[model samples]
Target: MLDLRSQAAATRRAADRVGGLTHHLTLAAAATLESVARSQLRKAQVDPVLELASNASTAEINEARRRRSVRRGQDVYLPSWREAAVGLPNLFLRSALFSVCSAREVLVDETIATQGDTVITMTGVQLWNYDRRMFAACLNYYRDDRPLSSSAEHPWVKVSLWQLAQDLKVSYGANVHKAMRESLIRLNAAHLRIRVKRQDVPMPRLIDVAFDDGYLGRDTPAPLLRGSDTVAFRVLDSMANLFGPSDWSAISDTALHERSGLSSWLTGYYSTHAGPFKLAVAALHQYSGSICELREFRRRLKNALLALEGEDIPTDCRIASPEISLLL
Candidate 1:
């Protein structure tokens, strides 16, 4: 009994040490983020367009000069002050079925069979992708310190469909237009109620919200939305808090546009950490956007790991089988 008690005491001490370390790390990270925020705000005082134009190639400068006489320190392109940020809940990031492309009501709750008005449901995949796209663009705009305009109704951030397509790295076509239109409708229509587990209780209700004001047009693309030949869209005021001082991760727009769903998941997983992480295959499968059987999951995950070899994942971090460790 004495020996058992000593062992238990040792375990408790170790856990306490780990907890203290975690707390310290969290404080350090918070301090770093605060410093970054201050620096970004300071940098915002300068005209970012001049920085871009200064770095442009001679040919590019000549083209801009031909269009409109380019001055040494004058702004070439107007900086977008519109901040279109979306704060996604942990539930939405981890397990929400926002990427189901079909129009059918996606069942979010595992225990519940039929989705009633109370049960959360995602509209489609386009909205899911749009959420990430807009979030990234908003972060970029914030980082660039774009000048805010006097538009009240379209306040958060205004982006044209063509620019959005370019950001998404997809060629604009009829299908793209249709998808954009339908996604705007679905995003505006989506209603969600999130429930989270707390130490005080088994489950605590977080927030009940809906996405609103998706597009800036009537039925079709406006002649010139935001001075561009594409449909204009704005971030909802409700989603504005997502841009506040919160946990944010830097996601590569290139990876997001180029990689497969599973590859993208791996990239995100790696971005969350600076070193190796040991996660179970089951957990990875759950987090991966790939909805497939165990065999198929293994196959795809292996391919994703393989694809990451030359990029972020170290060559030594190769996975020979299902039960393997990954280091990025």
Candidate 2:
């Protein structure tokens, strides 16, 4: 009987030891699976759009949610890293929509360029490099305000003229207010058209290109004169589409503000190209809509190239008889 009891006790001890061993094995297996899951998460590529949405403030998130329901997926938001940059359309930068010169001539279906089967045309008062700068400032404000995203049907922003002058790095005064008013009018008045022909298609398709519809003042009449007054700037659906994810380039505000006139235009032009090649001076002159003679433009081009280099942009000007080209 004593031997039987001792054997039974030994068996129970061994069973307990086995149970404990099984428990430890289970824990080890669970730990291994958890570690693998963590490693996989670390290796995964995070979606930038989702990350941007996640990092927004609570108010912004709520506002986005509210707007999402109202606009149905029209979320116009930029990543935090792009705060120092201004987003502009590649088509606008590539073409002479904003001419390098400050000529106020009215253009009616003026052909800007022809790329293969695509022909770009512009109408209304000529836009200059300064107008480009003002447009940039307006875009910056629109982004900052985080207004309710509007569809290609309707898009607008209510802005202050005084604040716009500050954005342009100019003093807020009568002259500055007058200039801002004129720029706003010009941007609203300008119209662009891009016609593309496909070999398989019989007719060319025209892309939508109403840039801006003009400004409406709150208390005063259209094109408000008071620097402190607010104006409703209508950004057409076509213009808003230019700010779409694939169509725009982020231009450095510092580089753009530091330069003016032709140099500034060059800065924006090159920002759109990832690998810039040698471009003929004649081509650039036509693209810039410069009123200067070819010889005079050559001198200005050299200076513009130097100015770009000063802003840490490398350039090589190739001068040959009967032809001049530049590589950036």
Candidate 3:
């Protein structure tokens, strides 16, 4: 009877704590909504099409416009016009959307990324255009990012960068523009084609134009139109606007999440429970060696992340015990 009562009491406490959190979260959400409404109402005061802060609709706007008074002979009268702006609501929503973006936790693969190392944040889709001849030609797609080196392996006769640049210099003399134009022309020639092999299978007529850029180390954006010899035309934009920027409005929430890398990043992070587990493994190495051996320590780390660290033992993982997942 005592054990039953203790369990019941523990359950009640958990329930109460959860209830408190829910209430606080709801209140916070309500406050945020109210704030947004107030901001929109303030903005509506000046916008002609937006419903006035008074919540007046299109009819009200027409009536207000019609009611405007003009001076007749010596008599003069005026009507006060309220603000109504259509674009303000959209601006508010976009601000909210970006808030969501900023709230997401940053996740990184430790194997590929080091702690404190800078990694590319894929907040949105990157657009690229085909125009490597002159980097400046792709200005429309420029965004702030350090240039990264992109390389590809070549055959026996290595074309050193210095040699290529020197050859271009001598051939084009002082006219850099003309040299670039002629180089692009040479790339366009059909005779310069490559064959790509995939899975040891030969593919017909493949264009092996590798792109290299200096933007990864530089604190400025690389030109988006830096396509290689095979690229003819291209443009970059949010994958959500694959059809075009004008079509972006039609993209649904579900579609946006899938197209954007953000959702995938979250789902992967949570299911994997990578960050916490890593910290746990590091902790185990500090104390007991045998009973708390490295293998056993890893088991504890894995179990903890699944929310079953002490409750349910995991069958397949670095650690088999459930006790590891308890955030210990």
The CA lDDT of each predicted structure is 0.42, 0.58, 0.26
- For residue 9, model 3's alpha carbon misses the true position, in angstroms, by 37
The most accurate candidate by TM-score is 2
Candidate 2, residue 308: the lDDT equals 54
Which stretches in model 1 have alpha-carbon errors above 4 Å?
A: 1-105, 108-131, 134-156, 195-230, 236-246, 311-328
Candidate 2 error regions (>4 Å): 1-81, 114-117, 144-156, 196-225, 243-246, 311-328
Query: Regarding lDDT, does 1 or 3 come out ahead?
Result: 1
Which residue pairs show backbone clashes in model 1?
87-242
TM-scores, each model vs. reference? 0.49, 0.61, 0.15
Q: Taking the tens digit of each residue's C-alpha lDDT, what string does model 2 give over 128-229?
A: 877888877866754544543345455556657677777887878666665777787777766666643221211111121222223344333434456666
**Steric clash pairs (candidate 2):** none
